[model samples]
Target: MRSLLFGVIAITILGLTSCQESAKKTPEFYKDTVTFDLLSDMKSLLDENADKITIDDVNNLNGAIRYYSPIKDSLIGKTIGELIEGQKQRTLSTNINLTQATAFSTLFTQSLKFNISEFQKIEQENGQPLNVPTYQFQNISGKSIVKLSGVVDYYNGEQLIKRFTIEIDKEIPADKTLNQPYPYNHDAKNQRDVFVRDNFDKLRKVWIPTMIEFADGKIYKRNPDKKGENQLDKDAK
Candidate 1:
């Protein structure tokens, strides 16, 4: 009887020891493995949620254009093409782009709250034992800028082990008035007002395409011709 009791106790101790060792070997976070693809996961998350938020700064720009009332959109049937083009240039000016991207990032992360519970569906699809989420932005401007807030999660399979909060802010331009919705240089009845109302759709057209191209890593050294050829014809003068 004494021998049997001792044997039972030894078995129990070995079982407990085995469980402890297993726990140790199991990674608590996905980052423990070098095989993790953090960037891809983050890109997925951002792409999935890109359109969910109606960005206020963008809305403000739209509002400014809307407030100007009805616009003819063309000067004597020639299309106020120059004015439309100018607005696009100013709207996407390098400085303004940086500022807008910074503001957007700040707003997006604030709303996201860095909550892991919100990402359960994503984790399951990606495989789990999630590490913290993270992200990187390529072109931090234009319509595709909407996809810049990449909240990435690491996953082993269906189990969330870890999550990282993606946070980024670009430097605002030194010029305080660069991207202001209302420019002091222009009055209520100014060319700025006229241009916006006339070219409301134009803004979306010119702005969105450039950004989409940039996001896709398509950089145009110069404007392409009808055949989409960038190289100029050497035979031509």
Candidate 2:
């Protein structure tokens, strides 16, 4: 079965190391899996909205693409500017003019997507120090905070199917000098591409496995056979 990886974006987008002593992952935790029952749960949503706006729904894409100097490369006229066709230093902004467009109001009644655990531990990059995003979601919600910078896997019975991973560090929440209250960053989205369908497709393929290292120091491979296999088979047939 294909997953939409609802929370998979915006977090786990970066890679790093060593902010704390590695904690041993619980054997059962490795057992507690991350699975999406979207076909069953989200069917209504897809049915209602999937067709209303297909990828071709994109009408026009407008934005500025700019190139800037690195933190160290300020002067030298290397400061950078608007991008040219194939400039050594460039930022390209191609406007996509589609025939149709989709509206945001459609999701009001259709929110079908997998959840991440909130009381659940958010996976920090292997070793980056913790910083507050200044935003807050009730850690108690058990809503999964999808790891943006990771790989996601799809399983069917005992079979491991197709997979891919992408980093969302660019979207990962950063530590803030100030903190906001709950539901602050939840559902926050910024449009990048003309059709978000392409972005969603990329996210669905990533395997955002939970971070539960064993006492022996090996990583946990999220096995879907135990629970999600039934759903996989149901969807497949």
Candidate 3:
């Protein structure tokens, strides 16, 4: 009876030891990996709720680590929950101001209109006729436009042929139109016309307002598109 009791106690001790060892073992995926490779693997393992990993997902993860150096030590051996908690803590530590820039931009764009009113022909010093384009900006926002800057994309049908910068520092009052000559010379205008004529079937242009400043000292900037082509905001028409 004494021998049987001793044998049972030994077996119990051995079983407990085996369980502890199993708990101490590192997961196979985490061993001998660091940096982006480790982050990529971690993201794949952690995001089980996702249907599948996407290129954007990978790119965003990579971007997160790109600016921070020596992140390998910080990320290794951390679980998904731990990583998320750390991110939240970091965000709380940082100071940032969220403003109503987008809302203001939407309002301004909805109230403004742009068009090429006409082309005026002028005789140059060399007795050559030069065609200059005129632009019209109509403000119906019930507020004056204090300052504006953006780009105009000239397209032939659906194809973009030329781009020009537009800047206005003076005040354009509510319910009024501001007519001005194209900021560029006749040579530039002729160049654009020729380029469009040779490359495409139809000529059209879109005004893409990038930044605007109002009288109250608030500013708005349009968000850039990732594909390098900016579209006219639907609200602006």
Which one wins on TM-score? 3
The CA-based lDDT of model 2 is what? 0.25
Per-residue alpha-carbon lDDT of candidate 2 for residues 125-200, written as tens digits (9 for 90 to 100): 6543221222221212122222322333433434444343433322112221112311111111323211222233
Clashes of each: 15, 22, 0
Candidate 1 lDDT by residue in tens digits, 4-111: 999999999999999878655522221221112522353453345445322443343234334332654322222122323334565566556466455444433332
TM, every model: 0.16, 0.16, 0.47
Better of 1 and 3 by TM-score: 3
Full-model lDDT for every candidate: 0.33, 0.25, 0.61
Question: What is the TM-score of candidate 2?
Answer: 0.16
Candidate 2's error at 90, in angstroms?
Answer: 55
